[model samples]
Target: MPKNIYFIALCLLCIWGCRESASKAGANKKDSINKVVQDAAHEIAGNFSDQRSLRFSANRLDSFFTRYDSLRTFQKDLTTFYTERNYAFAWYSDSGLTEQASHLYVRLENLPEEGLNLVLPYKHTLDSLINAANTQTLEQKSETELLLTSLYFFFAQRVWAGLEESATQKIDWLMPRKKLSYSALLDSVLKQGNTANVKEPVYRQYNLLKEYLKKYKAIPASSTTISLPGNKPIRPGDTSPEIVKLRKKLFLLGDLTNAGDTSSDTYDSTLLTAVKRFQRRHGLSEDGIAGAGLIRELNIPVPQLIEKIMVNMERNRWLPTDVRGRYLAVNIPEFVLHAYYDDSLLWNMNVVVGKDVNKTVIFAGSISQVVFSPYWNVPASILKKEILPGIQKNPNYLEKNHMEWNGPDVRQKPGPWNSLGQVKFLFPNSHSIYLHDTPSKSLFQESKRAFSHGCIRVANPKFLAQYILRDDAAWTTDRINKAMASGKEQYVAVKDPIPVYITYFTAWVDRQGDLNFREDIYKRDAQLSSLLMKR
Candidate 1:
C-alpha cells in the first residue's frame, strides 16, 4: 500500500473514535440535566412523578432558576426595608407589605412548593413587615403605637398578656404614694412601647400590678371598744341625765332641751325619736334599743366608717364589668338574696348560707330551671355522713323525713318536713349548688344564720318562685301550689336563663348612702380589706 493512503486511513479511524466519544458524553449530560429538572419539579409540586414528558419541548431548569433568583432578590429587599432606622418611612413602606407577607407565609406553610407560586406575593409582603418590626425603636411610643406593638409581639410570640399584666401590677406597687388613677396609670404604662422588648415598661407594669394585688390584701383593723358615760341607767320617758349628756356629746340637739321640756322625762320623746333616727342611719335594726348592738353602731368613729366604705368601693372596681344587666345576687355575709334588674333592686329576702364547716362559695352562673315539688337528690357527702348514720341508728328516721334509699342514692320526696321546701331555684354552676327554700323556718328568724350544706336556703321561697315564674303565663302562684300539693317531682324550665351571682360583701352603701355592715360568715372581707390597704 502507498504511505499517503495509510495516513489517510488512520486519520479516518481517529475521527470516528472522537465522534463516538462525543456522542456518549452528550447523552450523559442530557441524563444529568433531566435528573435536576425532575428533582426541581418534585420540590415544586411536593410529590413524586415521572411527568417530565409533559414539558418535552420546554426548558424547566431555566424557569426554576428565574423563580429562585426572584425570591432571593425579594428577601434581600425586605431585609433592607426592615433595618431602616426612619420610623415613618419603615412603617409606611412595610406595614401593608408585611400583612400580605404574613398571609402568604400562612398559606405557604400548609402548601407544597407548587402552591408557593400562588402566595408568593403574600410571602414577600409578610417578610418585609417582619423585617421592619425587627428594626423598630425601643424609645417611648404613643399609647396607640405601644398597644399595636404589644399586639404584634403577642401574635409574633415575642410577648404574652400575662407578662404585660404583671408589668402593670409592678408599676402600681412602686408608686405607693402616687395617687394616679388606674385608668391614667394604665394609659401611661401602655404608652411606653412593647414592655417585652423595653425593660423599663415591663418593670413598670409589673410593679403596678403587684401594688394593686398588695393593696387588695391589706385590710385595716378596727377597734371594737365602745365608751359610754359611766354606764348610767336610763328611764323611758325621762330623758335620763346621761341621755342629756350624750346628746351634748353627739351635738344632736344643740341646747339639749326643746320648748317646754326642762324636765328630763318630758324630753324623752325627742331623745327616743333621735335615737331611732340614729339607729336607722347607722344600719342597725332600728329597734331603738340602746343595748350592745346599738351602742356598737353609735361608737363606730366617722373616719373609720369612711375608710371601710373606700375599701369596699375599691373592691367593686376589681369586679368584672360584665356584672351589669339583670342578675340574682346572694350576699353571703349579709345572708340575703337580692335580684337586680338594670341595677335596681328587684327582690331582697333573708337567706341561710352554709355553716363554717360547709361554706357557700362565691361564683356566677345562669338560672336554668325551677323545680316545684322536686325530690331532693341528696349529695353523697351529706347522705353518707349525715343521713345514712341517722337512719342506721333509727330505723324509722328515713320514713319520718320522707326519705328513701335506692341503692346508694337517697331520694327525698316533697313534704312539709322536706329539707328543701316547696320551691327550688336551679342555677347551673360548677359548684353543683342551688338556692332553695328550707323547711326550717326558725333558722330565718336568727340574726345571723349559716345552716345549710353549701347551698343557699331562702326564707320566703314561695315569693321568689312567684317572681321568677311571672313570665310564664300558665305557671301562676295557685298552679305552683297545686303542683307542690301533688307531691310529685316536677321541673319547670325557664325560657330565658337569668344571670345569678353568689357573692360576699361585708360592707356596702344603701340607697340612702347609709353604710351597712353584715356579719362576714366567710371572713372574706377582712382578708380583702387587708389586701386593699397593702396597695
Candidate 2:
C-alpha cells in the first residue's frame, strides 16, 4: 500500500512541474508583445527630434508620383516640401508610423465636413498601412512617406488655398487670394502635433463655418418639410394647422429658441417673435407674418442649406489671413457695411448695393479721402443712358435737377438734393465705384436695398463722416456736422487710410454666431458651385 501511494504522488509531482513550465512560457510571450509595443511608441516620439534616422532617397518620391497618377498634380509641391526637409521621412519613425499619420488619415476621412468632396488616389494603400495588424514596424516605408506628404498638400490646398486665382477671376472675384507656404505651415503643425491649434492656415471664418457644417450635417436627412395650407399670409393670433408646422420648423432652424408647446397650432406670441427673427435673418421685412417670401425661405431643404454653407466656405478661403488695424467691409448680398478697428467690429449699418443689371464689383481698396457735400460728377454710362436722353426729352432736365455742365461733363451742385447726398467716400479704382449717401432715404426702409447704380449708398452718412474723422483732432463732431451741412464741396484727406473690402457672401455666420443666408441676387453662387462640384 505504501509503494502504490508513492507512485501516485510521483505522478502528481510530475504534472505540477509541467504546468509550471507552460505558465512561464505564456508569461514570456506576453512580455515580448509588450516590449514591441513600448519600443514602437518610443521610436515614434523620437522621430520628430531625430532627423537623420528617418530619411529616404529623393528618387523614391519621383517613383511614387509615377505609381499614383491622381497625386501627380502635387509632384512639384511635394518635391519642394521634401527638399526643404532634405528628403526626410515626415510620417515614419524608427519603429513604426507617427501619430500625425493617423491624424491626417482621420482628417481625410472627414473631408466632407470641410465641404470638400476630394478623392485620394492612394487612399486604399494608406488605409492598409494605418489599419494593419502589425504595429511594430511599417512596411513599404518609402511609398507610405510619399503618400502622406502628398495628402498633406492635398488637405492644405483644398482647405486653405481653395480654387486657383484664375478660377476666382473667372467668376469676377477680384479680391487678392490669400497666399500661404504649405511647407512652413506643415512645420508649425508638426511642432504642435495638433492641426486644430493652427488658425493661420485659413481665414477665421473658415473655422466658424466648419462648426456650422458639422451641426447642419448632424441633422437628420429625413427632417420634416413644412407646407402652409393657403397662399394667404399667416398673421399673429391666428390659429391654423400650419402653425404647428411653422413652430416645429422654426425650432429646428434655431430661429425659435424655446421649445414650448410645439404641438399647439395657435400662432402665439412666441411664434410671432420667432417669425420676425426669421424675417430679419433672411433680409425680409420684419412684419412677424408668414407670407410667400417667408414660406419660400422656410421650405429650403437642409441639403440645399448645407451646399450654401459650403459655397461660402470656399469664398472665405479666398480672403486674406489678416485684415488691417482699421478697415471697412461691405457685404453685397447682406446689404451691410461693417466698420472694424483693431479686428473688433466697431459698428455696422444698412447700405444699398448695385442692382442686378449693375452688379457691384468685388475688390479691395483704401479709403484715402472723404468728400463732404460732394459734387455728383456723373459717369459716362449714366450720362449717355439717362442724363442725355432726359435732356433731349425735356430741354430743362439738367437745370431742373440742380445740375449744370462742368466742362464736357455734367455735375450736380452739392446740397441735400444732390444725387451723392451729403458725403462720398472715395478709394480710387478702375471700376470707379465708391461709397456715397443717397437723397432717397426711403430706400433704406426696404428689406432688399439693391437700388444703387454700382456705388454703395450708405444709410447714415453723417455718422460715417464722424467715425472716419474721429481720430483727426482737427476735425471734431461739430466740425464734421458743419462740413456735411456746409452745402459747399470740400475734399478732406483721411488722417490714416483704412482698407476697404467689397465682398459677396450669400451665406455667412454673423457676429451673434447665427448662420445667415441671403438671396443670390447677383446670381453668383450657381457658377461658383458648379466649378467646386466638377472638382
TM-score of each: 0.55, 0.88
lDDT of each: 0.53, 0.84
Residue 329 of model 1 has an lDDT of: 81
- Name the 10 consecutive residues with the lowest summed lDDT in model 2: 43-52
lDDT of 1 by residue, 61-164 (tens): 23432544433323333223223312222111222322322332343343221111123323454444455654544221111222232233322211111212
Candidate 2 clash pair list: none
Error of 1 at 362 (Å): 1.0
